[model samples]
Target: MHKYVRMAGFFGLSEPPPIPQSLRNPRGFRPFHFAPDDRIICFYLDFWHVANGDHILHPHALMFTHSSTLSNYAKYLSVVPDGQSRRIPWEAWGPSNARWMEGNFDSSYYSYVHGSRFAYKLPSSYDDTGETQIIRMFDFNPYAVRHSAKVVPAENGEEGTDADGLRAYEEDMTSGITHRDVTSPSVVSAGSFFVDDVHSSLPYREVARAVQYAEDFSILIDEANIILLTEDHTMRVHTM
Candidate 1:
């Protein structure tokens, strides 16, 4: 079956005493694997407009792992920029879209696209890696509608850098599949698959308006089963 099961509702979050203003509108869900049997999902909340003349992309993140239930997740705040005269380029001075790299079991790498000028590969967590590794970058061409890029980290010291650095390449998407067509891809595993939302009739569509946005959903790949977080905010488990 294309869809195993569908859940409906919002993934609620408990307010942490005095909630920081940044996590007010938590959106953008990016799911990645932490281990073969574990999953970690990251949600990015925009805090761009709150910065008053401070050139920073003040976004906050909410992380959910196997150790924590959906209702009980950890919140992280971005560090403020050092008060220095060095200016951040205007192209990189706003909120960015983050996506987890598939097959990165160490959870050390992810990509973020800033504006439409550049896309960068950055370490997932500075504390875990102790260094911000800029694996590669693509200078975006505004005139081009879409491009194909791949960043593959060296395996077993193959590319001359340490065993952990990445090598990347980019090319235009000339086959007619535009970037917007694949902005939000499906999350699939060996046993089951998860989709943002299933097709519904007009009567049900009116009720599912709130959960219709793709960014509000995530999928958890459990052993022999799949947990889908539907646009309507409900979670459902389908057995293989």
Candidate 2:
């Protein structure tokens, strides 16, 4: 991770993912499309494990890092293999690179740090002069975890766009593990993903509208309505 940060300070990431026109539902289509906010970064984590009669057993997990680049208005996705310390960006790790290519950790063998979880950094800024910024620290134990960081909208909006604000939106979307079959508790962190209208104090109708097609727990906000989708597959629409 340190090496990648240093490299980012040097060469920096290449082209990022094109900004989408709208927040199309990851599973559906929409007529009115809005381009994605470049300031936001989204991170995703997935884990699955088999259980013995009364004891939990074997676990497998994988994490993906994707964020909107404020500079180029694009998205960069970094795929992380589970239970392993595979350094991202091919150039950082090669034949002689022991730190980056130390191989992934084993699931069965319990450890203090790398158990069966993973996480990645969200973009803070895109200055041409690469100054290092720590996005967030993730402490994941096999059973519990904690995240520490400040989540807020960037103030320098008129300059161009609030890259930090966009990153806030992305972080909100991909904070936890949303299961396909189970409905987990819905949480609305300011910048974390899946914030509903109840906390937002919007009318019920608008909350419904926002969630209708907000894809992957995202909202489309301008001067009108705020659309929100929860991790449990619930949608909420809110009026601005």
Candidate 3:
């Protein structure tokens, strides 16, 4: 056996989530994992624009590698139908996962699951491989996107040294971004995350539509970080 295989045998996980039978061939989606927090968010659609009578609904989905972390990485786990887990070589959601999909779908019109899911990673060691920590995933629903940083703190020494006169005017003043940009964060890459409307009251298609466009949203962690995603027949991520 290879050296890495031997190491995995010593400290490897037991099992991961499995793909649902109906969503197997199509690969419905992967559960989202929020970093610094253990919350998973899942997204899926019940109906499509086609008029085939509900058979056109494709479910299976997964995230792609945008960050350097999963540039050439593999899967780690999979979710089963019965809530059981299994281990896989691919790195869908590993130990670094943080946030995930939750209840956000409703049975309505003008709304549907646009993309797959959004996810993040926490600071973790990749099996003591001495590899640098990083975040990476696949873009689920590709589209146009943009992002902007709401400055909380300015760089050092640039605040305010002296006023018009030759006197110390340290009152914490700097050129603020007074104008709002019309552009939003560009969706660079979609995170390899997926969610199911496992807890919905209406049909799958109805729930998918409502959740896809619903504006009511809650971010996982609120730190000195900013992420923006958009849709234009593709997915993109803005890292600022």
Candidate 4:
């Protein structure tokens, strides 16, 4: 298995039915992050992988990369594949290159260091006495694995930048592959795509949650505050 595929096992993924071509190559969406620490870049990846078992995984995937890296990635995505490494030497690119690409990636810090997100979920029937929304706090400091340095190839005759022997160690860290089935876990790190093999972490936990009437139109979050906008154009703010 190519080393990069470790995210499959780390995220508790197994070979399932073929993914539609459109989703296999993800299209990113809705970029947001908990206030206070913008270090953890949270965005929705327009894709989902049917997990190895019987559960619907949340379709949100987080990616952390330099804005320039993201910009080049955008430009590269637009290119029709011709079986060539899209790696452009650092000297050949400039800020403008990334400025024109999808501009969602814009952080240059380690992280807010700590961040949280709020989701207003539809209430389950017959349970009126509860908070229908959830506020999940993520320890984003753990996933900042990339750095500007030369990457050395494996000394044991492996290809360049291929992760070596990380699967066994990472698998052991989780209770049972992953708790990411129907109920999302308090995991800090997650699967597939790319996280530097050298560093992966589980730093997420349920911090706080709240609920509002179905008429609540939208919700947003900042350092220690929650903002709600209703369909009637009235606004409400709550302290976290």
Candidate 5:
């Protein structure tokens, strides 16, 4: 039951789109597979992509191990129950996962969620000043996932090689990469693998102040209304 389970890294969020960016059009992560016992999960949200040089804004939001509020409410819980699926196979998706997405979130990419190692979730050695503000969850339980090789097939020999070396030298290279970035394959994830900060247990009735410094957001509780999707792509509706 512990033959493998090593995934730790973090720091994501900031792909809400701007400068002609829309809503999650090939953004990232969105998986699910839960049958009589086939368990699996995934989710995505980037808060509107920007970055260090673009100024600043690399928000974060993800999912995977959700065994239904472990207690203390589990940061108000992020729902996702009821069968799930979404195809998968394109060689698992690049060099398998290019050694866990170029490696490093300390060793991963700020995400992991395979829970149920007997309801895994421990850390009560002392701190519990009445839940102080709960905001820390990291679980593990992977069966098999060790990937490598993330994308190779370009040998121009110079001028950029093959992720698009100046358009393969200039106009019509035969390789692609959206615009740039790719071709650093020395691979590592040998396979593949793949939270934080809180406060707010229902109070804010509305908020979308033109996103001055909004970090991350996502909501959709129905029975009436309450659909917020902040980080500046705007969308606020509260009626419930």
Candidate 6:
């Protein structure tokens, strides 16, 4: 018996499945989805194992819903081959790299694993299809940027001389020094009408123009809404 099995038994818990001889001990268990209605939990198990005499670390998943105890649960739909040697990076091991859309154990549940870009759908008991569906394969580039034209000055003019030149020089220096001073707040408010006009005229102007990287991607789903947290630090909510 594995040490984990003995430890669980000591706590009055049922013994878990024995680790395969080809696989090493598992580490880094991360829970992803929970269905309160059905008392179901989905989680990832990361481990290092020897495959073809090469050591590799990868992740697999399990779901506990109908089982009588924690030890007995449904393994993920896919399993790593015994001799497969794929080394996943240590930094990539976490819940942030995955997302889940929970459904009442009666209809449908969805999950996406980042590196694989595969969306898995598990149907409920009421589903007549009785088959799992993988759909909508899409590539995600977190560092994707929406390119736009750069702003440029329409024309340049020579500086005026004497009084006008001195005044302009002073104004330029003062502008640079005070650009972010307390007075700028009032100045911005004072130009509220102009700001509104600019906004209205360029309705499509990007407020926070920045590239979104995959690392900053986040998503949340509820019964009536889906919320996405993008790289630009913006929350986009969509109704279901």
> Residue-wise lDDT of candidate 5 within 60-91, one digit each (tens)?
33333222222224443345344653444324
Two-way TM-score contest, 2 vs 6, winner: 6
Question: Which candidate comes out best when scored by lDDT?
Answer: 4
- Choose the strongest candidate by TM-score: 4
List where candidate 1 sits over 4 angstroms from the true fold: 5-121, 128-132, 135-240
Kindly provide the TM-score of model 4 when superposed on the true structure, using C-alpha atoms. Answer: 0.33
What's the true lDDT of residue 81 in model 6?
65
Off by over 4 Å in 4: 1-38, 48-60, 64-84, 87-132, 139-202, 212-214
Candidate 6 on 1-240: residue-level lDDT in tens?
Answer: 122111111111111222354673346433432222212223433334455877554223222221222323224213656777555532243222222222222112233322212223222211334332212221121211111122221222212343213212111332221111011101112121122211111001111112222333344443334355655777765432
lDDT of 2 by residue, 86-181 (tens): 334422321111111011222221111111112222222223344432121222211121111223334543222233343222222322211111
Q: What is the TM-score of each candidate against the true structure?
A: 0.17, 0.19, 0.18, 0.33, 0.19, 0.25
- The Cα error of candidate 3 at residue 166, in Å, is 26
Off by over 4 Å in 3: 1-86, 89-92, 95-98, 107-150, 153-240
Better TM-score candidate (4, 5): 4
What lDDT does each candidate get? 0.27, 0.25, 0.25, 0.33, 0.27, 0.26
Tell me how many clashing residue pairs each candidate has: 6, 22, 76, 6, 22, 4
Model 4 per-residue lDDT tens digits across residues 77-144: 56857766566642354222211111121122111222423222222311434334433233223232
lDDT per residue as tens, model 1, 42-142 = 33332222235553432232222222322232232224445644444312421122221222222211332222211222333233333422223222221
Give the poorly placed runs of model 6, Cα more than 4 Å off: 1-37, 51-53, 64-216
Query: Which run of 10 residues does model 3 get worst, by summed lDDT?
Result: 202-211
lDDT tens digits, residue span 53-156, model 3: 43243222221212223322334332354666655432343322211222222222212121223323322312344443232222222221111222222335
Off by over 4 Å in 5: 1-3, 6-11, 16-82, 90-92, 96-184, 189-240
